[model samples]
Target: MIRLLLVVAALFGATGVMAQDFPNKSITVVVPVPPGGVVDLAGRLAAEALAGELKSSVVVDNKAGASANIGATYVAQAKPDGYTLLASYSLYHEVNPLLFNNLKWRPESFVPIGRVVVTPSVVVVHPSLPVHSLKEFVDYVKKNPGAVSFASQGTGSVAHLGSELLKQDTGIEMVHVPYKGSGPAMQDLVAGRVQFFITAPPAVMGYVQQGRLRALAIAGSERHPMLPEVPTSVEQGFPNFQLNPWVGLFAPADTPDAVVRKLAAALEKGLTQPKAIESAKAAGASVSFQSPQELAKTVAQGRAYWAALVKAANIKIE
Candidate 1:
């Protein structure tokens, strides 16, 4: 019994040492998407905040391709130390599992560090839509039915899922036009190739301001600072239409609890800094730090939510 206790103590002691010496070296944050996108921006901001908080050189490595499997697999197989981390978002974590038949990694692949930033999706329409409000837009869509088309970043993305939710709630019919990325989607939206869109404030704000697009309401509960005049769907009488994409940090599975807590502390405090807040706000992302446990809860809720959504939407990758 004494020898057993000694062995347990030794194991915990080693874990303690590891947590204490935690980020002794430069940390690498792997962004699954290419540079210059919303996820990439959020990842870079998170890396900057961590560097300031932990006093370490944190670098962002972009490993883009294959629906984020490449970068996710890289971090999933990385050493279970605090140094290697993944900056991932909602679609990658929640929807990918429901969309893809074969994934390289599962939810157990990483331990939740915390949620970093949340980018709100807004419902915007082309200036030619003749809809000044969400109700008017809904009415028009109901009248036109399948004639009205809405654009999404891809199948099984937040836009797609959110749009599906909107369909279920409003009972409106619109053709889904999936794009490779938001850039092309936004361009086509501005050109009137598509009549409606629901995306983050960054890509749509400029167009709305320029009169190229008309924003009806934010999909979430709160209005974005960039587009303060636009109300939320909840306020506009669509309480069910809330879909905000968030980015989270994670380490490989089996990471020590102490280490995860320490990193979560840094992440929470770093997100509160004015620089971090300003930087995130500038990128149309808001810093809302979630503790490790809180993030895990959110992940679970998102999983069930997306699963039901996929089943209802009849979403298929192929």
Candidate 2:
């Protein structure tokens, strides 16, 4: 019994030492989407901030494909030694499994380190569209019926699901146009190919300011500070129209609790920095942090909500 106790003490000591020296080398943050989008920008910003906090090199790896399954799978299968991490939104973890059938990794494949930021979706219309407020847009869509089209980042993206919820709520029948990415979709919306687009603020706020597009409503619980003139969907009479996409940091499941805590602490510290906060705001995301336990609960609640949404919308992807 004494020998067994000595062995256990030695094991704990070794683990403690490893945790103290955690992330002694460079770390890789995997982004499940292409560079330049909101998620990608958030990942890069997070990498920069985390590098400063850890005093180690942090690189962002863009492995975009298969609706974020590719990069998520890469991180899920990576070594759980605090070296490889995932920087993605809740959609990849909470919504994708409900939408796709071929995903190799499940939500349980990751251990939440911390939540980074939450960005509200904005509803913008092409300049040519003959509508202004959310009420006008809804009325226009109802009148035009199949004459209007809405663009989304992809078939099963948050943008798509949000629009689906809008259609269901307002009883509109606009056609759905799926784009490879938000950039192209916004381009098409600007060119007047699509009538309406629901996307992140960073993607359309500049255009709205330039008068290329008109802001209708923000699909959030409250109005966004950046777009103070635009009211929220709730204020516009759609009380249930809140869709905020949140990005968080994660490591492969089975990562040591000590390592996870260290990383989470670094993330919380980094995200609170003025530079990080400004950078995230420039990307149209508010810097927000949540502990691992809080993030886990958030993910659980989001999974339940999104699962029912997907089922209700009949959103399916092979």
- What lDDT does the true structure give each of the candidates? 0.89, 0.87
lDDT of 1: 0.89
TM-score for predicted model 1 compared with the true structure: 0.97
Q: What is the lDDT of residue 253 in candidate 1?
A: 98
Q: Which residue pairs overlap in candidate 2's backbone?
A: none
Worst 10-residue stretch by lDDT in candidate 2?
Answer: 37-46
In model 1, what is the error at residue 253, expressed in angstroms?
Answer: 1.0
Identify the candidate with maximal lDDT: 1
Give the alpha carbon lDDT tens digit for every residue of 167-198 in model 1: 98899998999999888988899999998888
Model 1 is weakest, by summed lDDT over 10 consecutive residues, at 95-104
Q: How many residue pairs clash in each candidate?
A: 0, 0
Candidate 2 per-residue lDDT over residues 150-202, each given as its tens digit: 99888778778888888888889988899887779988999999988888887
